[model samples]
Target: MAEQSLVFSFFLIFTGAAILATLALYTRQPLLVAYIVLGALLGPYGLSLVTDTALLADISHIGIIFLLFLLGLDMQPSHLLHMLKKATLVAIASSLIFMATGYGASLLFGFSQIEALIIGAALMFSSTIIGIKLLPTTVLHHRHTGELVVGLLLLQDVIAILVLLLLYSGNNEEQSGALAFLKTLAALPLMTAGAFLFVRYVLLRLLQSFDRFHEYIFLLALGWCLGMAELAQAIGLSAEMGAFVAGVTLATSPISQYIATSLKPLRDFFLILFFFSIGASFNLALVDAILVPSLVMTALVLALKPVVFRFLLIRISESKKLAWEIGFRLGQISEFSLLIAYLATSAALIGQEASHVIQATTILTFLFSSYLVIFNFPSPIAISDRLRKD
Candidate 1:
C-alpha cells in the first residue's frame, strides 16, 4: 500500500505538470513557474496528494548536481579558468554590497542581529537554475555574455559553499569554528586533486576503451559523477562541487559531448522534481506574518542585484550591453538561499518567520526573473519568436 501510494503521487505530479506546462506555454509564462504552482496545489499544504515532500526533495537534489556536471562538461578547463579570473573581482564586490543591503533591510524590519546576518548571507547568491535554464544553450553557450554569466555564477557558488560551512560551524562550539572552516578549505583542494588523478589514471582509460558502447558510456558517466559526489560529501565538501569536478576532468574527452546530450533528459526529469519540491515545502499559514518583509526584500533583490552586478562588471572592463544583460540574468536570489534558511532554522539559529521570509522572497524573485528573461532575451522558452533560440 505504501509503495502504491508513492507511485500514485508521482503519477499525479507528472500529469499535473504536463497540463500546467501546456497552459504556461499558451499563456506565455515560464514552464518552471508552472511546475511550482502544480506542487503548491497538490502538495501537503494544499490537497495533500503528496505529503512526503522530504523524500522527494532529497531525490530531486541530484538534478542540481547533474546540472552542474553538464555545465562543466561544456566548458574547456582553460576557458573556465580565464573566465573565473575575470569574474572574481566582480563576484566579490557584488556579494559584499548585496549582503550589506540585505543586512540593513532585515534590521530595519526588526529582525534580530543574527537573523539579519543570516539573511544578508543568503542575499549574496543568484539563482544558478534560472540563469542557466533561460539561456539558450545553442546560442549563448558560445557568446561572451554566457561566459561572463557562467563565470560570475561559479565564483558566487564557491562563496556560497564557504558561507554554508560557516553556518554549519556556528552550530558547534565556538572554538570549533576555525577548525571546521579550515577542514572545508583543505577538503576542496584535496578533492580537486584526487579527482584529477583518478580521471587521468583510470576513468579516462575506461572511457577510451568503451567509447563505442553508448550504454556502457552512460553507466560509466553516471557512476563517475555520483561516485565523486559521494566522495566530496565524505570529505566535508559539497556533492555538487564534486560532480562538477567529475565533469570538468572528462571535458576534454572525445565523448564528453555525447554524455552531455544523452544526460540532458535525465537531468530535466530530476530538475522538475526539484522545482516542485521547492513549492511543496512552503507552509502557507506563515505567509501572513512574513508577507510585508518578504515583499520588501524581494523587491530590493530584484532592483538592486542588476545595478550592482552591472556596475561591477563594467568596472572590470566588460562591455556595457553585456554587463547589463549578465546583471539582469542574475537578478534573483538563489535556491541556496532557501537551503540556508532551512539549515539555520533547523539549527535554531533563526526563527521560523525569518525562514519563511527567505523562502517567499526567493520564490518571488525566481518568478519575476524568469518572466523578465523570457520576455527580453533569447531563451529556449522565450515568449517572443524572435527571442526564442534552441
Candidate 2:
C-alpha cells in the first residue's frame, strides 16, 4: 500500500505536468508557468496529490545540472570572453544600481534589513532561460536588440553563478565568510583560464578526431560537462558555472549547434522538473506574510528592470525605440533570482519567506513576460509608445 501510494503520486504529478504543458502550448503561455501552477495545485498546499515533496526536490537537482550543461554547450570561450568584457561591466553596474533601488524599496515597505538585502541581491539576476525563450525564432537574434539582450543576460548569469557559489560555500558561518568570498573570487579566473586552455588545446583536438562520429561526439560532450561539473563542485566552484564554461569551451567548434540541439531535449526535461519542484515545494505559510511584499517586488521588477536595460542600451548608442523594445522584452524576474533565493535559504542567509517571495515574483513575472513577448510583435510600437508617455 505504501509503495503503491508513492507510485500513484508520481503518476499524478507527471500527468498533471503533461496536461498543463499541453494547455500552455494551446494558450501560447510559457510551459514553465503551467508547471508551477500544476505543482501548486497538486502540492500539499492544494489537492495534496504530491505527498513526497522531498523526492521531487531530490530529482529536481538533475534539472539544474543539465540546465547548466546545456548553457555551457551554448557558450563559446572566445565569444564569451569578448561578451564578458561588456557583460561584466554592464552586469556590475546594473546589478548594483538595481540592488540599491530594490533594497531601498524593501526597507521602505517595512521588511527587515537582512530580508531587504536578500531581496535586492536576488532581484539583480536576470533569467537567461526565460529571456532566450521569449525571443522569436526568426533571424532577429542577430539583430541589435537581440544581441544586446543576449549579452546582458549572459552577464547576469555569470554574476548569479558567482553569488550562488559564495553564499552556499559560506555555510552561513561568519568565520567562513572571508575564505568563501576569496575562494569564489579566485575560482572565476581559474575556471575561465582552465576552460580556455582545455578547449583550445584538448577539446579542439579531441573534437577534430571524433567529428565524424555524431553519437560519440554527443556522448563525449555529455561526459565532459558532467565530469567538469563534479570537479568544479569539489573545488568549491558552482556546478552551474562549470557547466556554462564547458559549453563556452565548445562554442567555437563546428559541432556546437549539434551539441546544443542534442542536449535540448535533456535540458527541457530537467528544467521543467526543476520548475515543477519549485512549485511543489513552495512554503505555503508565505502566502499571507509575503503576498503584499511579493507584489511590490514583482511590480518593481517588471517596471524597473526594462527601464535599466533601455537606459544602458541607449547609452551604448542603440536607438531609443530598439532599446525600449528590448527592455520590454526583458521585463520579468528570472529563474536565477529564484535559484539565488534558494541558495540564500540553504545558507541560512535569508528566511524561507524570502524564498517564497522570490518564487512568487518569478512566477508572476514569467506570466507577464510570455504575454508581452507574444504580443509585442503584433503590436510593435505598443511598448515603445507607452514608454514615451511615461
Candidate 3:
C-alpha cells in the first residue's frame, strides 16, 4: 500500500477521531482511549491506511514535549525541588517493587533472564503522558496532586535515562561501558545550568520586550521549547525532559500563564496524534503470541504499582486519600517502556518475542490505567462532567 500523505493522514485521523470520540463520550469512556483505538483501526497494523509509522511517531512526540512544557509553566522550581526531595524515597521504593513484580511475571512465562530484565526495567516507570495529560491542573486539590505526580515522574525519568544509557552502551565490556555512560550522564547537569542561564539572560528579556506582540511571543515560546528539546537530545537526555526544563525556566516569568494557555490547543492536537501513533505502531499479528504472558505481566503491574506506591507513600506520612490517588494515577507502564523495547530489539539484546511482550503489556496497561484514573479522579479528560477540570 502507498504511504498516506501527512495532510491526508491528518484528515483521516481527525475525522475518525471525531466519530469515535463521540461514541466514547456517549459511552462515558475516556477520549484518549478513543484516540488509541482509532490508531489501531486505521494504522498499518489494522487497515494499513497510515503506513508511515516513523513519521507519525516523530511528529506525535512534539505533543509530549508540549505537554511537559505546559505542565512546567504552572509550576515553580522551588516547589518541584521540594516535592522531588520529599518523594525520593517513594519513587525509589516503588520502582524496586514494580521491577520485581515484572521480573517475576516475565520469568513465570518462561522468558530468558535478559528478557525479564528489560521487561522489569520497563515496568518500573509509569506513563508520563497519561500521568500528566489526564491530571487536571487548575484545581487546588489537583494542583497539590500534580506536584507529587510530577516529582515522582521526574525521578523516574532519571532512572529511565540510566536504563537507556545502559541499553545503548551494550554489554561488551562492563566496566568501560559503565564509565562511558557516566561520562555522558555528566552532561545533564551542565546542560540544565546552561538552560537556566539562557532563559534568564536571553529568553526572558525577549519575552518581556515582545509581550505585546502576541504572535511573536507564541513563536518565540515554540522556538524556545523545541530548541531546548533538540539540545537536550544532543546532550543525551530526552526531548520531553528538555521541554520540561524550558518550561520551568520560564515558570517564574509573568507571561508563563499566557504561554501555557496558548500552547494547550496545539499540545492537544499533537497529543491526539501521539496516542494515535501508539495504537498504529502496535502489531496486531504479535498480540496473540504475546497475549498470555503480556496479560500476566500487565495484571501484576496494574495490581501492584498502586498498592506499593500507596504503602510507601503512607509510610512517608502522606495522607491516605492523596497517596492512594497518586498510586492509581501512576499505575501504568511508561512510553519509555516502548522505547526500551525498540532499542533492545535493535541492539539484539532481546528477541522479538520479548519485545512484543513489553510493547503489548505497556499498551494494555496504558488502556487500563487510563480508565482507572479518569473514572476515579479529576482529569482534563474525565468521563464524568464534574470530574472534568479542563
Candidate 4:
C-alpha cells in the first residue's frame, strides 16, 4: 500500500501478465486465461503482491468504457438491421435459458434470491473477446460457424447491456419498478435517435473532413463513447449500455475497421489490467463457501451453453456442424460476466460468496473453452470422416 510498493506492484503485475500472455499465444491459448492466471498468482489468493487492487480496478474500468467506444464506432444502425431478427431471437432465447438454469442452480446451492438472479444474469453472457480471438480468421469465422458465433454473441451483448440497465435502475428504494422500467424503456428511443443523428450528421462529416488525422479520430471516438455513457447516466439509463449503443451506431462506418485496428492495442493493454484487477480483487475466503456452486455453474457453461447455442443456430437455418462448432467455441464464460457479478456484489445486489462463485466459474470455463476450441480445431475433420463412412 505504500507509494514505492504501489509503483512496484503495478510494474511487476503488468510485466508478469505480458510474459504469460506471450506464452499463452505460443501455446495457442487465449491471452485472457493467461491474464487471469497472472492475477491469481499475484493477487490476494496467491503471493499477495498487490495491495491496491481497488485503484487498479478503477483504472482498468476505463478500458471498458474505451472498449465500448470502439465497439460503438463499428456498430452503425443500418448494419444492425441487416441481421436484427436473428441476433435478437438468438440472444434473447439463449440468455433466458441460461438465466433460468443458472438461477435454479444457484438456489440449489443455497444462494439467496437476489444473489441467484444476479449470478444467473452474469452467466448469460459469453466472452466475445475470447471467442473472436480464438476463432480462425480463414475458415471458421468466414463460414457458417463464424457468422453464427457473431450473431449469437451480438445478441448476448445487447441482453447483457439491458440487464446492467435493469440492475442500475432497481437499486434505489423510492423508485417504483414500473416507473423505473418505463424510464429505462423511454430512454432507449431517445438515445438511439440522438446517436443516429450524431453519426449521420456529425461523426460521418467529421471523418470526411479529418480522415487523415488519426489522432483526432481517436480522440473523437473516445469522446463519443464516454459522452454517450455520461448522457445515459443523466437520462436514467446505464452508462455501459450507452457505450455499447454508441459502438453499434458506428458499426457501418468505412472508418470503423481502422478505428478498431488502431484502438486494439489500447484495448488489449486495458483489458490486461482489467482482468488482472479482477483476479487481484477476488476474496479467497469466499472460495470454499461457493466452490460447489461455482463448479455447477462452470459445468453448465462448459457443457450446456454450447448445446443451447448450437440448437438455436440450427433452428435459425445454420448447418448442424457449423452451429455446433460455434456453440463449442463460445461455450465458455466471459469477462463481462465477471464484471457484472462484481458490480452486483459491490452494490449488494448479490453476495460476496456469489461474486467468488462467478469468478471461479468464469476462470474454469475460460480454461476449458480455450482448450476445447483451440486444441479441438482438428476434431471437425474427424466428424467429416465419420460422415463419409456413414
Best prediction by TM-score:
1
List the RMSD of every prediction in angstroms.
Answer: 1.3, 4.8, 1.7, 4.9
How do the candidates rank by TM-score, highest first?
1, 3, 2, 4
Off by over 4 Å in 4: 1-7, 25-29, 72-76, 136-150, 169-171, 174-176, 236-240, 346-350, 377-390
Show how many residue pairs clash in every candidate, following the order shown: 0, 4, 0, 13
lDDT scores for all predictions?
A: 0.88, 0.72, 0.89, 0.75
Prediction 4 global C-alpha lDDT: 0.75
Tens-digit lDDT string for candidate 1 (1-390): 889987997898899999999999898889999988988888899889899999889989999999988888877888888998999999999999999999999999999999999999999999888888887776744366777778888888889988888888876887788876778789877888888898899988998887889999999999999998999888777788888888888889888999999999999999999999989899988988999999999899989998998898889887787777888899999999998998899889999999999999988899999988888878888999998996
Superposing every Cα of model 4 onto the true structure, what RMSD results?
Answer: 4.9
**Cα miss at 68, model 3 (Å)?**
1.0
Once model 2 is optimally superposed onto the true structure by TM-score, how far is the C-alpha of residue 129 displaced, in angstroms?
1.9
Model 2 poorest ten-residue lDDT run:
381-390
244: Cα error in model 1, Å: 1.0
Tens-place lDDT per residue, model 2, 1-390, is 878986787688778889997887776565667888887888888778787777776666666666666655555455555655655565678899778977998888776898788788888877665666555333444344445666777677667766675667665566576676677678867977887798889888988987999898888888888877777777777676677677767777788888877877777666666667768777676799988888888888888978887888677666788777777777776777876787777777777776788788887777776677655642221233332110
Q: In model 2, what lDDT does residue 76 have?
A: 47
The digit string of per-residue lDDT tens for model 3 on 48-72 reads: 8888878989989999999989988
